[model samples]
Target: MFLKNAWYVAGWDSELVGDALLARRLLGTNVVFYRGEDGTPVALEDRCCHRLAPLSHGQREGNCVRCMYHGLLFDATGRCVDVPGQERISDKLRVRSYPLVERDHLLWIWMGEPSLADPAQIHDSHWHDAPGWTAERGGYIHYKSNVHLITDNLLDFSHLAFVHNKSIGTRKQGGVKPEVTFSEESVSVRFTTIEGAPPPFARQLSKLPDLVDRFNFYVWNIRGNYFAQDSVIAPPGDGYGSQSPLAMKLHTFIALTPADEGSSHYFWSTAHNDFTTDIVDVTRQLTAQVTAAFEEDRNIIEAQQRSIDASPGAPMIAIAADGTLLRIRRMVDGMAAAEQARPVEQTLVFQPAARV
Candidate 1:
């Protein structure tokens, strides 16, 4: 039930800093990623086309991979260039080479039909590297749960009341009605608490008075997980939804990537403007506090996964607040359904050549 023609975050660029073979299971496919001397990243099927040995366990020869099992050498493009004790190399002797693109310090891999992969469609996570902003302390966390469940959790933020009470949640967020909106490309659910007290931790450094305006928002796009927490504190009655030059502001960015059905990868970073140095500093340095909230998220999601594993078909009810989550689920399910039904004619046209 996965969409093949999409870009998934393989990993952070920092993970591949050195010449190392990174092994990861994405959407149930074993992929091995490594860097060529030219600093280009390459991804190929982890299994050798010959003896089914894992290339990750093999050695790198320049930009190529040597499957030590039978000494078959595959170039970065996944074409077999050499075979020990043999002079003939067949064009059929190659493993899949997935499309890989690096942008904004994140490595995005396309795991579906190679012909349909478009770098332009990779969702822009530009907030991390946008000019005039400071993106701090990018972090990664691994979770044991279906990626969809995590998306469901993010699509609806009402869980913060019980899950993140100690870290960033206040009772006020539980009562605010979220504005959910959608289009062909994305879905957003936003909650605004007018003149309500800010999260306990945020109040420490905020110049904002006891009663100020704040918002929590979540976004789901075609190919990536995204959400934000924003605060632009204007006095209770002065105004709302507009930024003031003197107002203190806050912004946090969170994104997710899937590894497999039973597990997933999480990537996150926080960014802020110059308006409130003190408040932003608290967010920057109290990353652990922020992390704790996510850990709380993990605890709940993993438990839910266990329940789902035991009874996958069990019905889960949706509430009024679930309008966005339902739409998000439908969007992904729709894309996957469409890909599954891709015409046979379109697929057969791309089939490999017959053996000579």
Candidate 2:
């Protein structure tokens, strides 16, 4: 699992509107999203305070969620407003509300201790407000795998050789020669394929600069612009056979948010310089491709989770191709450990929520 202090992509900005309840996950917590009467985005624990019924399953009344179970109403701040059929309810009664912000077409929520919620802490360097970059953003996918596994997959690039052979991999690109570098916060790998130069997909990208038939580039750009590309076989799990590509292109972003302990929601978006003129067509095409790729991954990850459940302490073998995966696992494990060791202090101050 990623650090609670770090920002996780929850959903797209367009999905968090209307008088409807939108359910999403962040930092392993389930949250229900809705808009207040003022049209600002608000999030609360999906489960109601009373009988734990999903508030998302109920109707949105103005800016509050009216629980269908017992007519309990919760405002944007999660303050309980009314208890139907009851003469009086405690003013202290409330459900947990999370601080949510929408930026760069992605919805971000603070799932850590409420006192630590700070928008400035979230990394927005690349996608927030950078010059010379044009981004076409959209919605995401829901996956059934552990969020960690999805992160592992994103951090490593070798899977392109086999799992994505039809879409992005070529026979000559099988040999490994990756440039690896890292920092306290991230790792990057870069690889160039000279022999199995370009796959079929590369033909479409031929119009781009610096791309040639003899030299095809495969870069795995990871955390906060930490870029890396290498040949690495992802750890194998039970249930799904790796076949068929679901995603459209090679440069798609894969973000994972833990829906719970056993399941995760996968959010993906692609940005490229070539499709600026026809972003809508490009986005639609990319979304369809990525959605298919996600399905392929879903089958495998779910099966792997089941296997892990059955065997609590099973050891697995890894090879040279797994160096990046190992590094990713170590990084994640280290982050988790560090977070546990030095918990961030939470301090709450009154600040008006940003209007969407």
Candidate 3:
């Protein structure tokens, strides 16, 4: 339920390449993506005109996607270029094209009004662009819950004690209560963990001795560079427990984009000042670990959704730990309401038309 008007990370920079038709879901719509002859990324409705087959399954032919079912070719602009059997078709038959841009090793597509698509609005963290910090970029598992849940989880740092204890929490630190603060667009939670000596989860991070200490964890909604200890925790379902404290020292950038009613795309990048020389390798290992954690979350969230669907009328209960989740739900609901009240004519766009 984040702002649809804003730019969201779709895929890693390396994922997009020459004439490859990538099918991805963004803002509840199925989009077909490909690179043009000029090496620019383009997006269009996935559905083909000849048949309803997804253009993603079609062949990439010199910057155009040729429908596999009917051999109809469409250019990056969504114009029907080649109709194998027919000579001519009306312009109305053209597919809808969306604006796309590449930045900071990521692919961003406009899912709202094309005219409001502002590439500059896309949130980019300073560490990602800084000279000393090495970046490891990739994506994570798709979740069944709404995108808002993911954002809520990211914004909250208290779950580390119980849910992610094995990975990020120390038994001694669990008793420490956190002071939480919230703003219109972001939330900040701060707490302290014992300094010196690695906790149980830190065993895996024996290679990094400098990171063992009391840490700070901070989550901001808008866009800024700030460091906090790595006490942030995510819900645990599959017995993975939490990640080690040292892992949190490696800064992570996460972008959650809605795929549809019950799906989402999570793109992330990890960076750190210490592991600059081996950031890529460290990222590869960390990505695998982080992905496992997400998989654990996916199973639980999907099960939760199934339960909610089965008992729509039943009352739900919550505890103190659920505060962040509740706040996030409220924010999402509010955004949805605001969007609904506005006329469709005013939808956000990537590129606005010139004023008369």
Candidate 4:
């Protein structure tokens, strides 16, 4: 159900420490992520070859992880380096190592063919390592709903009117139709509100006039599963920032990884270029507000998931506001279908507990 050839966010740059092992499930496979002694990121199958124990449960020995169940040591490359009781370690005694790269303060991993894993394919987000932008990252939430359900909720902004009425949206901005456009690599959904009042969260940045222009843009990379939302509120303007004095921008990047078919791991962060020296504190406050709004969404989405699970045959009726969501669903369905139809030799089926 996932696009295997793409890079998915394994964790934040700060999550993996030199002496700690982080275990995360991506695309239904359990994987362990850690930083080596030299501060390089490494990703390997979480399960050990011997006794099928989780490597993350074992302790780190030097640069390698020694299986706690049997004292088998595996290196960053997933090769069996030492076995306490055996004189000769079998070459087949190892786990699969995934290609991992650190970019934009996030660790991304590839789950498909090693030959096709390219670091250049990682998607970039605005305000990530930007000159004047301040970002608050390392925030995550687990959802009981499918990953696509969250994607559907994100692609359509109409829900913001009700879901986030107290924080970022008002009834005035919900009815506006987004100008949707697509390219070979990505899809853009944009909504513009002119002469509208700023939301509660934006008001915290600065004092503004009664009516301002608000712009919300969502850019989705179809193949890579990367999504970014750029929100700009400015003086009733020509475009982006014609009036620099009264402009504020908040950018959010969402990394969605399927923990399994029924659940997902969602990571997000917010950034802005409002205050220079105090930007970090400003971003932190903004992040907390957004987190509260996300909790509201989490409650709703999880309840919806429960309903779907209770009624397996229930059908959802899509409305006009669901245009972007439906298109994305169709694209995902097509990709999953194509992957299923491919020849067995062309696909690398990864079993979560299997040894390399």
For model 4, how many clashes? Answer: 0
Better model by TM-score: candidate 2 vs candidate 3: 3
* Off by more than 4 A, model 3: 1-3, 85-88, 125-130, 172-181, 194-201, 206-213, 220-248, 275-289, 346-356
For candidate 3, give the lDDT of residue 140: 55
Best by TM-score: 4
The TM-scores, one per candidate, come to 0.88, 0.76, 0.78, 0.92
Residue 222's lDDT within candidate 2 is 34
Q: In model 1, which range of ten residues has the least summed lDDT? A: 347-356
Global local distance difference test of model 2: 0.60
lDDT of each: 0.74, 0.60, 0.62, 0.80
Tens digits of lDDT, candidate 4, 272-308: 7763232446666788788988898889999999999
- Clashing residue pairs in candidate 4 are none
Model 2 Cα RMSD, 1 decimal: 8.0
Estimate, for each residue in 311-339, the C-alpha lDDT of model 1 and write its tens digit: 96999887887876777788888877888
lDDT of 1: 0.74
Runs in model 4 deviating more than 4 A are 275-281, 344-356
Which ten residues in a row are the worst by lDDT in model 3? Answer: 347-356
Candidate 1 at residue 182, lDDT? 84
